[model samples]
Target: MTLIDDRAPASVARTIAGISNGELSGSTCAPELTEGPWAFDLGMPGYGPGASQGDLLPAGSAAQGELPERYRRASGEELSSWIASAKASLGSRVAVMGHFYQRDEVVQYADFVGDSFQLARAARELPDAEAIVFCGVHFMAETADILTGPSQAVILPNLAAGCSMADMADIDSVEECWAELEARFGTSPDESGRVPVTPVTYMNSSAALKAFCGEHGGIVCTSSNASTVLEWAFERGQRVLFFPDQHLGRNTAKAMGVPLSTMPLWNPAKAGGGLSGEALDASRVILWNGFCSVHKRFTVSQISAARAAHPGVRVIVHPECPMEVVDAADSAGSTDYIVKAIAAAPAGSVFAIGTEINLVQRLAADYPQHEIFCLDSVVCPCSTMYRIHPAYLAWVLEELVAGRVVNQISVPSRVAAGARVALERMLAARPDTTMAA
Candidate 1:
């Protein structure tokens, strides 16, 4: 493994993506992002300039390329002290946001921890906040940046964290697909003649993809609001072309009573429209070729194995899984919906779940008496989401207190305005009672 260039942010970004994907693996002990000590935590007060945002190693910070003595300890008291001091040194503007699947240690400091949409929503709500220390992956922090104001800086604690699912849909491929689609669908605007096509992408995509959607009357979506987003597309186009995660599109449309016959698969490598009538004409949603690697690991064999070993078991999965897997399962929904469903399930009932390892383990730990285990009995997490560590959180916040900033993520006025229009359409379609997206 190559030593990460602490100098080039771009190089660091690539290292992060590679490390998370298991393409570059090594053992390094230094806690690159850990902040400061607790006694010094209460040293500074709210918004008082002291340390710069990019100053990961403030003057009083521990020696470079080494873990702080405080962080190396086992006690929560020690951990708390380090976090508190880091918070103090960073100033009052620091806010740590954790995803539901974050490790317990990282989750310990999250001011707000939730699903991706929830985190983005929180970042948007705190427009005036000086720094958003995201305890998730690069894509998530990027999403937060798009939602927040320009002045407010967004950050990922660990530079190594990145999402594989998000990576599957690059801007170049989407652009290429769009060029081909226009030839097949007719470039004339929707029925109202306002736009040629209403492009809707899953929130898991890059900002560039979102920009593509925005530029072409497109919007973004999470697992929760996919249905509404698709319906919004229907109003503007003859058909909906969804991407990256084929299972999500298939499962969501199926739930809306979109017949399987009406839905067709779109193989990116295949030539021309990659589809035709009966399959295309009968279709309500056209799915992309991408899929979630982690979700794909969960299989029907695992589900059956669990059922036979533990009778009266309930199996639930995310929409990212294959249709055959979903078909054999008891139910399916987004992370938020999954949480609610499991919480509502009767106590003592065993559940075999198919999703990220961190979430399933966290759920199992959260709910005792009720036996809960992952559909796949393996130790795995979304490699990208695991990137942000507590040290990074402290570093970003410290920079804010010092009146300097790093990784400022903000959608431009033009892109944001267009994106907002697409987003509003999806939001409006979803009734007030449902907040899954």
Candidate 2:
């Protein structure tokens, strides 16, 4: 693997295309990734293009229309110039936030770049900006909208940039699960004032899910604060029902000493989550059957390969990975945690990261002093994040400069109110800790 010198002039799209055309020397999980993201927008309704391409999108989910030809046909240089012009025109009226998982091309334009938790804080802090352009995914934009003031518009560059994991737990399915839980374990509080069940939704979920948590006396959690939020839930409820990502819930709860046998998987597609009454009675954490397709790709074999190749190499993974993979790694944490760990390591240290490819590749470029590479060598980015191509960004910014709000993501007032309560609870649960890009 080669270190990223400055930003790789070759964009991810270009690299994948080069590999597909047999003009470049590298590996990619899929050749279909070579196609332009707009191509997917015009065709099937899967996650635009990348890692989660095979994952299913829920019915009635919004689909992006064909991008304007002017933006679509423009070269990278042209798009960059247009984006610059729009940003210069908008000035302080706009604040662009990027997720760590975004490609270098899109991330370069962000005023503030960090993990979803950090970006959520950025959204709330940027009260002066008239608009917050989220260069991440649909859920992140919905989160920014929920966090930002009503006057500040939160715009998603591409309407199809949605998380597959987040889509797995739709409003109807979750509502059904909640009803079953309430029936199985009555809504009454225990003698210690703890309720029978407390709903905890990961930040990756839709605003509707966050609101559902708030309305149900539950809370929202991020990868950075899953343990803290889970602890809060335990204080208020006898057993917690965590949704959207089972690995995160199980890993965080297990780290807190919750036994694996007590954490039962709740399959939304099955009756009563396919669990017997005795199993439900002894449950400590009811995990949802949903996972990040990107993280799920990592494995213990990859960690072993990294160690075998580079003796003393550090293996760090995200909590979203399967529990066995997390257990096999040297350490596990959030994206911010992985970045910080690498930053603090001694010079010349070799590190293997298990997460999305974009952040890992960028980190390799940013810190040439150390050796950093993704555990999975086959280049596969978060499919949803990959959907936000630079063209879409330029289009959105140009639209903003033209006094038009394009792809604005707004949570309904009722849903926002509920989501806000849960998000605020998450904020309060955060530890007194500092994070860096």
Candidate 3:
């Protein structure tokens, strides 16, 4: 079915109110919205935001399930009015930070928009802002929470909007893996000299994991600064255990000429099976066996197909893809890099993109003359990111205005101290600190 043809607006609209605030799974709330009208629109490569496309759904109708019981069913005009009122109500006390790949609906409310690391910095820049509404996933809010003061609280509109990539590694699993790594690899202790190993958790991980990194000498890193982070690790330790996403570690290491054999995958399900004799001996950068499902769907076959179908199609992908896929693509970088690459490209060029569907579709719409296509033929998106619906956004902001203040994500003081140490170490070590915003 055509992406537009399959959209059941009534079904999607009804599902909004039906969803529980904190519940994410189909069992808990809206019966796992696996397929819907919005999902259909996502299938259309390069289909942009509703407001951008002039398809803003009619608001404040007599229809019962179209909107919440409390507020007037909002039209584009009403939506605009509510946003203006919210800003007026909060004034400069509330600072909204949007992730680079956020949908236009959420991004529209952002006072500052940037990548993960830049968003962290953005939060610090607004230390005085009493409330920081983060328009990203759970971990991003956690990062903002850690970076900001105790006076401020970080809020996620949809509490369920989490990154599966982050979930792939937890503090428990990581601690277990590290104990095994230390016993097996036997790294010399860090600067404090008591701890045997350095735990370098990616910034895309949970705050608890960051606290673990902080408790140990491990630092947090994003796609933009993984190399600088690794360099710092090498100066301090014999080997670095990188977590959550493997491809990020591999690609970053490869760029620095660390041999593939040196990078071993740590599988949590396997007790001791993860450590091959060669893997332990040959490795410098140990990678956890995890991936971004959204990026994993972008195969070499899709790249080949896009190349054949649209001659001269420039291919780009996130570094979270496997080495073979990164080897095949024309370019690879963070989400911001992908957008900027397309923006700088000549108008006539055909570009095939690999990333989250929303950002790719948004790019295609923005650059209409140039043919832009997703690397995957099958319609798929980052399921975690899909949790942030417009209705949830409106509800969260309204709750803030009502003074109820639901879903405030705060990092524990001990965790924040540890996490801050790691983050500060990263910023100090990095020579060229410029990152995408």
Cα lDDT of candidate 1 equals 0.64
| Model 3 / residue 361 / CA error / Å | 1.6
Model 2 vs. true fold: TM? 0.96
- 113 Cα displacement, candidate 3 (Å): 2.3
Q: Each candidate's TM vs. the true structure? A: 0.77, 0.96, 0.80
Better of 2 and 3 by lDDT: 2
In the order shown, the candidates' Cα RMSDs to the true structure are 10.7, 2.9, 9.3
RMSD of candidate 1 to the true fold?
A: 10.7
lDDT of 2 by residue, 150-226 (tens): 89999998888899999999989999999988988889998999999999999999999999999999999999999
Model 3 lDDT, full chain set: 0.68
Best by TM-score: 2
Q: What are the per-model numbers of colliding residue pairs? A: 10, 0, 4
| Residue 58 displacement in candidate 2 (angstroms) | 1.3
lDDT of each: 0.64, 0.88, 0.68
Q: Which tens-of-lDDT digit does each residue in 206-292 have in candidate 3?
A: 888888887777888887688788887877777788888899898888878888878888887787635776777676888887777
Give lDDT tens digits, candidate 1, residues 250-369: 887787777888777777677754777457656667778777766887789998998899988989888788888888888877787778878988888888888876677668767886
